[model samples]
Target: MQSRRKLRFRLIVSFALFGFGLSALFAFAALNIRTRVEDQLVNASLMDDAKWANQQAREHPGAPSGSRLLTGTVLSDRTLYKAPLTWQSLENGVHDIFEPGPDGEEHHYKLAVYREGGIISFLQYDVSREELGKQQLLFSVIGAVFLFGLLSLAIGLWLSRKVLKPVSELANRLRDFRKAGKAEPLAPHFADDEVGELAHALDEYSARLTAMVERDREFNSDVSHELRTPLAVIASTTELLQGSPDLTEKLSERLKRIERASRQATELIEALLLLSRAERRGPTRGETTEVGKVAADVIESQRPQMRGKPLSIELAVNAPVSVNAPASVLSVALTNLIGNAIKYTLEGSVRVEVGDGRIEVIDTGPGIKPEDAERLFQRGVRGEGAGGSGAGLGLAIVRRLCELYGWDVSMRPRTDANGAIASIRFS
Candidate 1:
């Protein structure tokens, strides 16, 4: 997936860029106009100085004494020359040049040439001050651009916060609702705007969802209560039938099966109810239970399912182990694993090995697909090798039970054979 920029950051960057672009454009235009105006003014002044010096030469026919104008003349007769030796190669128009002045400082000058009455006059106007002024103006414009750019950034930040405050609040409220189960109503906290509408919608959706969850809990509780009564009656009746006098072996075996099925059904209901309650109220306290007893009960309860198949079930209790967890939860988790092993195995044995803090159900079933490893425990996701008789919820319930008790459950293929091993480790 591609990473995305946040809305607030994008907005602030856009405004800042806009500000910089406008400031740069204005600076460029201002500097260009000022340069053009200064060049024209300097050229006009040089032209006027050159023309007046030419008139002075025409009237006097010699050097104009005591004149402060930095002017020189070269007569065509070569009889009355007053121009510098460097002006001998001068052109007939204005030229801007840099030369050393009397004070030894490099100076910019506009040299203008005017010819009239067989005499050429050269006027040099020192424009170094004006050049420095123009530079100062350029610097001022650059400084203004930089200064206003910073101001624009500050303003952009302010505007972004002002505009995005409502959005931020809405986001905080959504996060708070997830963590704390309630948030202030957004519409009442903000103005009637688009963000307000989004907040209002979220608030309504949260309310509806909360109510729906409450209804679901109530329904599960009611169903569990309603189902337990008949299950208890069935269990008592099955026990009574098993104890009847003159009961045949065949009838006694069938009654035992019925009793096991009833108990399994009752335990299934209880597991589901406990799972639902745990989701709503968090995990309840656990009690110390004999792990071996739970494992044996689950294995015995699942034995009837293997009757018609060429498969065997074995229990390998290596050590006397115990765990701190709900006995029903442990039974359900083990039952799901053992049941799946028996249900899927075409032949061979389903082995339950009890070890320290763990139980491993190794089966000779077709090994699970490596591609389905991550998804096998998810609800409604059946591996390709899973038989079609189940809703794919057994492992999902097992996963939930493990989560509630902080246990670890894992399944992987057995590399030595065409089988899989499911392990549940208690923390």
Candidate 2:
């Protein structure tokens, strides 16, 4: 994957490339213009000098002399025959010529030929000096292009810092708010600009979010408080009824079920309250709960759910396991895990193992897909065979409880059996 470049760095590179391209373009045009103009002027001067020398020779009828940079030759009927065959039929225009000089090296020159009145004239001008000047001009333009690019880069850096200063300040302020777990009015700290508008929007969002969280906290508290009152009454009433004498065996068993349900509801409320607050409920000072005892209790509470299915629930205490949390918290977590196992298993056994600072509930039931192991823990998600009455929040609540207390919970399909294994590692 390609990594993203920051906006500030992009701007700097754009400036540098634009400067280099424009400078190169201008240099190219200037060089073309200079070369064309110099050639035109040189051609005109050569042609005019050739014509003048021809006329002077015609009027005076004598040989002419020339300077080091220029030479003119007037050829008449008699002298034309002495000229080389190549020069005899030359046209009347500027033509480039290369000839061997006294040093046996090639020399470059421009020949302007003129013909009129039985006389042809040639003016030759050396252009090697002009070529040297063109080379120097090309080097100078190249240097200027690089210089302009560097200057543009410097300017871009300075402008970028100034332009992004407000944005950086806003980001820093938002970071501070996050660390402090509270938000302040961002607009008050910024000037009236785009950044300030952004800050105002963030402030509004933070206010709405805070208000919504406060309402949720209050709602959970109110619900838990009201629910506890009725649950307490039911528990107290059941206890009183249990003290009655002359109770039949069947009646006593029914009462025990009611009592167990009432206590389960109370524990469920406590767990839900803890989840709502997203806080840990540590065991009381100098207290710890044994994992095996909690697991056995949770299994017994959930066994009533089998409803006469050909399913058996078993608990295996592999080793002495304990955790630094209230039994109610552990009960809530284990209840959900073991309850799901027993509910899903149709005819086979559900085994609960407590050891090694963890508990594993393995059941022979309709196994889960490996891909959906984590998804099952999400709220509003249900397994394939889930009953219509299920809200799918059991595993979600369990996951939340585990996270609150720094426990690790996971579900996976059993390798040797057609069922699932769920484990919670308390570390």
Candidate 3:
């Protein structure tokens, strides 16, 4: 998975790492170069001292060792055999030697050997002081690396705060906009920079979004107002026709269906308008809807969907429940659940249960696939066995309505039969 840490955190980390790495590389290079130069100079000096000591021994036959030499006298056949075994094989060049001292600590030194015929000269120079100096330099370099890293971290903190200020201000303003339910231009509060450009873009997008929303609300209001007129006329006409003096029984039944459909359409329009406006169907104005009644009405309205499929519709009210919502909202939400249950079931039964602070529609039909259970509630998504000219928006509208009213809706496959159960839990 990718990291979700803020950009400022990443920037700070990058700065710290860069500073640490550069400082460490420079310190390492400096230490290496210094060690190489010091080693070269020490080796050359030791070699020159040895050669001069050899010349002096041959000229004066005996001479105190040069100041750089560890041995004052050159060993001959008698004394050479008694010298340290490591010094016996003398070559005409410089060499480095290491051996354990009497204290079990290793000794470090440079060896310069001069050999001529039966005479051999040995010169040694201890490098313990140089080793001590290199150790001190190593410690200093390590300290400097750490010091630079800390400085980088401090600088990162300050720079991140300064750099992210505009972005942070933008976020704050956006948050305030949400709380106030309004959008204001952010570019005015910022300087001409990348953040300012982002603010300008956001402003343009918000304006477009606000205009689109306004257009939608106006269109929905206009459509709903226009449609209410026809639905009223149909309802009044159906009532008048039902009172006809010679109305036949079959004709009367058909008229009653027409009346029910008109009423349903009117209620659905009110509910959908509330959804489009994103207005809560609150009970502030004496509106408390009974769950069982809405479920029954929705079931009756959806019966024509059966199409002589021999399907049974059932309503079970195990408990009395009421909600602080408009009856039309409940009607629309229940209509979707009950309608879906009826649509998918060719035969068998669709049962609606309203109680326990919620409602559920259980249907005996081709059960939903486990994977498609959640997707079924999404817009433009339908079950595999869906058979209709539906655009697959019923469940999506239902879900949006439920969210507006602080309710939850879900569907699950039934374990006992080839069916699905849809639920709405009111909160």
Candidate of highest TM-score: 3
Residue-level lDDT for 138 in candidate 1: 81
Candidate 3 lDDT, 171-275, residue by residue in tens: 999999999998989899999989999999999999999999999999999999999999999999999999999999999989989998898799889988998
Which digits, one per residue and each the tens of the lDDT, describe model 1 over residues 53-156?
A: 77767777666622235644435537535566666677677887788998999997888876777677676778888778888988888888888888888888
Q: Write the residue-wise lDDT of candidate 2 on 365-409 in tens digits.
A: 998999999999999988876353588998998999888999999
For model 2, the run of ten residues with the poorest summed lDDT: 60-69
Q: Judged by lDDT relative to the true structure, which candidate is superior, 1 or 2?
A: 2
Question: Which pairs in model 2 have colliding backbones?
Answer: none
- Give the poorly placed runs of model 2, Cα more than 4 Å off: 32-69, 72-126, 386-389
Candidate 1, superposed: residue stretches over 4 Å from native: 1-25, 44-96, 103-105, 112-123, 149-186, 189-198, 279-286
TM-score (C-alpha, index-matched) for candidate 2: 0.84
Q: What ordering of candidates by TM-score runs from best to worst?
A: 3, 2, 1
Model 1: number of backbone collisions: 0
State the local distance difference test value for candidate 1: 0.81
Winner on TM-score between 1 and 3 is 3
